[model samples]
Target: MKIALLGAESTGKSQLALALSAHLRNSGLAVHHVGEYLREWCDTHQRTPTQDEQHHIVQTQIARVMATPADTVVIADTTPLMTAVYSQLLFNDHSHDDLALVHQALFDVTLLTGLDLAWVSDGLQRDGPHVREPVDQKVRHMLSQANLPYQVVYGSGPQRLENALFCMGRQAPQWAKQLARQESPTRWSGLCETCGNGDCEHRLFTGLLVP
Candidate 1:
């Protein structure tokens, strides 16, 4: 199954994804961790492109990952929603059409790691010419408006990782546990019914189980 960890900058998304991957691996599950595409693409191109280009690159990376042949879990650090937020801020315009495309491109489950925890500003550089708070709020609103299936994870380090794990496991236990099983040779190359139909939000995030 594919899972995405999304949030604002310096919110520990990458660290959480890495920790979750390790935890799942220790439990004997094979997982493919997909890092942030925007950063990687920027490095490859040797120059940061406009927000529109970044949005396109994010979509392209997600499509590539979805098409990849993997037996177990595929955990993505960010998704198209984040790109849409960046686009909205940079372009001073938002499109329902673009948002629809992003909403349709996401995985069955998306876990939104929040910025409620203490801010660790180290290693956090100015991402292009954008400010942080506006970008963070834009992303939060995008996820909320899309009505995507997501859980708010709060904390730092292991606490944050544990919170994310619990949220994802609760929302998608079947898919999460399936990682422990043997990998299937056949991959889901095309978009699943849930992917294109926009119905995954209802089925995945409804009825949260309080621990």
Candidate 2:
């Protein structure tokens, strides 16, 4: 299953993704967590990206993750629609057209993760035209208008992660159960002995049958 966790800036999507991966791993499920695309793009370009650049960065990441092997359950930290919202709200550039293809590329599940969380004003600060609450509300409205199946995960820290994971686990597909049995038993440890690294930890197969 492909799951996208999306929200406005500083809404804890990254932390939630990491925590979910950790929790699932601890439960014995193998999961692959795809970090934020915007961060990758910024590192590659050696500078902060413009609004349009951000949109394309997210699109590229989505495409790459979607192309991953079928046995993997990808948890993308952000989605293209999020880039569109950020650009339109912060840069006054209505780049919704750029996201048309991306909108179509989304999988069966897109979990919107910032409905009840307070917005934080750090990292990539915005001013002038940016309005946090209204913009978030607008994003929620857009998702609803698109008829996307999404659940708002509220609360703070671990509570939010718990809520998000609970919602996602409930939506877990039946096919995932079969895939779990097929996965290598060692993959559930969230470790890579070859490179002696824990960064690419696997967490998907940890709890396929458990609630």
Candidate 3:
């Protein structure tokens, strides 16, 4: 199973990818995690890059995803579609090859990370909280236009993981199914009295963002 984690900045996409990979691996499943290549690029440069630099990042990300061994499940932190969205959103450059490649790319499932998660600023290339919704809309638009199989993951903490596992079908663990059955998630306050990610919802097999 190839799972693509798609979302805007600070939507928990990266963290979810890592968490899922770890979970599956711990379950004795083979999993390869495709890290965000842009992080390495930014770490090396010490600043955001120009439009030219973005092409390299996008292409590198695609290459990394492609190079991943897919005999087993592979979780991508962010797909090239995200790079295309960022390209259009930030540089206003949509003609790049990355957009075309991402549109053509296929995945067994694409989990659209909800914008209603805790925001973590990486302090360099990260955008502010205000752009989260708009960028999320853009990512959803791309997925819709491409006619991809996707679902919105709309919670944090355990609920968030359960939603994703449910979308993954049989790939989900027994515990994940149990959790999904026990708790009904709704759109919670961005922060909770105890768990900041409480009161969220699960939106599987949907085109909408679950809003």
Provide the TM-score for each candidate, comma-separated: 0.70, 0.68, 0.77
Residue pairs with backbone atoms closer than 3 Å in model 3 (clashes)? 185-200, 186-200
- Of 1 and 2, which scores higher on TM-score? 1
Measured with C-alpha atoms, the lDDT of residue 190 in candidate 3 is 34
Candidate lDDT scores, in order, read: 0.62, 0.60, 0.69
Worst-scoring 10-residue span by lDDT in model 3: 192-201
Model 3 ranges off by over 4 Å: 97-104, 170-211
TM-score of 2: 0.68
Rank by lDDT, highest first.
3, 1, 2
What would you estimate as the lDDT of candidate 2? Answer: 0.60
Using lDDT as the measure, name the better of candidate 1 and candidate 3. Answer: 3
Give the number of the best model, judged by TM-score.
3
Q: Cα lDDT for residue 172, model 1?
A: 84
Per-candidate clashes, comma-separated:
0, 10, 2
- TM-score between candidate 1 and the true structure: 0.70
Model 2 lDDT-worst window of ten: 187-196
Error of 2 at 34 (Å): 1.2
Give one digit per residue, the lDDT tens place, for model 2 in 104-147.
Answer: 34565566654344556554433322465566666676666766
Query: Model 1, range 1-211, lDDT digits (tens) per residue?
Result: 6788777777778888899889888877777887877777767877766755765765676675676556777888776666666667667646433643464445766776654444555432345323656776666566566666666665556656655665676678876564443643232222221121234333333422324
Q: Work out how many backbone clashes candidate 3 has.
A: 2
